[model samples]
Target: MKKKLLVFTGSPRPDSNSAILAREAARAAREAGASVEVINLSRLRLNPCRACDRCRDRGPGQCVQKDDMKKIYPRLKEAGAIILAHPVYWFTINAQTKLFLDRWYAFGGDEYQCFKNKKIGLILTYADQDVFTSGAVNALRAYQDIFNYLGAEISEMVYTTAAGPGRIKKNKPVLKEAYTLGKKLVS
Candidate 1:
């Protein structure tokens, strides 16, 4: 079967650097012959996980709260690969992205085991150009740890520095690298 990729973006700002990178990566994934779906978390009415543990009792992929995440659960399970695109916020992922990921706990327990060995990609944007000093480093590590714990493999991570909206477009190298990372995820 052909590979299916799910790209999720947590940037609330339209035309933000992270959004641009996510869109570019999706285009490249499509060009590489993978089915792609892009989900903008900011546009969705999603709620944070309540930690009720009802999902664990019900079965695999079950959640108690009813919200927009219902639409994402199926796609997430079906996806062969997943890409997360977000701007650095307070040294870590934005609230939207964190909320989305926290819900993945619904798929936990022995009854649910779909997330093993899935390919993962990350596109992070930060205003600080210095990788070490920027909050991006901590964000990247957090993502790496989460993906690793979920039994997923990190295919690639593309970090770009852009201070303003649409500013990343001027950096050809970063754009090219994002596209290449997308292609690599599928191929």
Candidate 2:
């Protein structure tokens, strides 16, 4: 069976570096025979999780609020692999990304282990040349913890440092790496 990859871009700017990289990766994934779907969080109307523990009472995968996230839930559950592409802000993920992730609470609870055994990939872009020294490392670690808790395995993580919009295009190595990661996902 062909693999299905669901990619989420957390950058608000349509032309942001992170978005570019994500598009490139998605293209490569398509070329490698995987079906790909890219969702830009900036264009969606996703709200943050209220933490009301309503999911538990509703029996998992249930959110009280009906928003754009309702569209994403089914895709997420059906995907064989998931990719998160975002630009680092203040040494962490952007607000849009955080809000989307927090809403995953609806998928929590023992009954909804739908995320288990799924593969995850991360593509992060930052302004600082040394991401480890720029506090972005913590953001990467946070993602790791979240995926681990969800019973998903991280197959690849690609990080690059570029300041201006579309500057990531100048980094050939990173672009190549992103493409390679995508191709690997279907292999």
Candidate 3:
């Protein structure tokens, strides 16, 4: 069976560096015979999690709020690999990505079973030269903790400094790295 990859683009801007890298990765994944879905969080109607612990009472993947996130829950469970491609904001993960991830609490009913043994990929870009200065380090650390807690494997991460809109396109190595990561995720 072909692997299915669910890739989330966390950038708010259309055609953003994050989106570009995600699309490149998705394209490579498709070429490598994986089924790939690329979803842009900024374009989705995802509401923040209410911290109401309703998912525990209702069951895993069941959240009270009716929104696109509900639609994503099954996809999350079905996907063999997941990738988050986003740009750092204010030295940390952007709001859009956080909102999406925060909703992952809905899977807590199963103790985050959906993430266990799953392959994970990251494509992070920032406006600053250094990862620490850009706050990408903080974002990576958070991902490490989350995936580690869930027993997922972080297979690849491609980060770079793209100081402005479309600047990431000039970074050939990062682009290739993203594509390579895609191929590896499905292999």
Candidate 4:
């Protein structure tokens, strides 16, 4: 709890392009003297929000579903900065990433006070040539709406077009951007 940053990598593919961006960012955050944790969503057993309204009453840690999400509740509350790195699929955020976002409803019990002023970052990868065709815009819009509603500060949103796994490693400028974002998030 109370760590500098928590990066959730939502790609199902291990070491994907989005994951590379997350790694670069995390490395820079560490160099900036920030504590960082990079969590791969694929490695975690996460369930979609059932919308049972259990968390809406008590807020924060009150969730009915017993899953890995329980482990994230306090960390999400305590992290100074949060980064969501994921690949776009079907013209929107991937399933796993969307599920994670949905579960943030649990934190709504306190009117999302846990997210107020929290620094948030996003790194999105898509297969198409640009944001539109890649459908990265869709995912970006969703994140914008979600974070804005939560009263969080979106430090940065960096997206790239990487057609295959780890292709983002070739995009040096984006990588550097993510690094800069990491430092800025903590500062």
Measured by C-alpha RMSD in angstroms, how accurate is candidate 3? 0.8
The prediction achieving the highest TM-score against the true structure is 3
Q: Give the TM-scores of the predictions, in the order they appear.
A: 0.96, 0.95, 0.98, 0.95
lDDT of 4 by residue, 92-171 (tens): 99998988888888887778898999999999988888899888998888888988899998988888888877777788
lDDT digits (tens) for residues 24-137 of candidate 1 = 999999998999999999999888889888988887677877799888888899998999999888877888898888889889865346778889999999888777677889
Deviating ranges (above 4 Å) for candidate 2:
none
| Residue range 113-155, candidate 3, lDDT tens digits | 8888999999999988899988999999999998999999999
Task: Write one digit per residue (lDDT tens) for candidate 2, span 58-168.
Answer: 866678889998888888888999889998888888788988999888887764488898888899989898988766798899988998888898898889888888888
Whole-structure CA lDDT of model 3? 0.92
Give candidate 1 misplaced runs (Cα > 4 Å): none
In candidate 2, which residue pairs get closer than 3 Å at backbone N, Cα or C atoms, i.e. clash? none
Residue 111, candidate 4: how far off, in angstroms?
A: 0.5
Candidate with top lDDT is: 3
**Alpha-carbon shift of residue 125 in model 4 (angstroms):** 0.4
Q: In angstroms, give how far residue 11 of model 4 lies from its true place.
A: 0.5
Clash pairs detected, candidate 4: none
**Which residue pairs in model 1 clash with each other?**
none
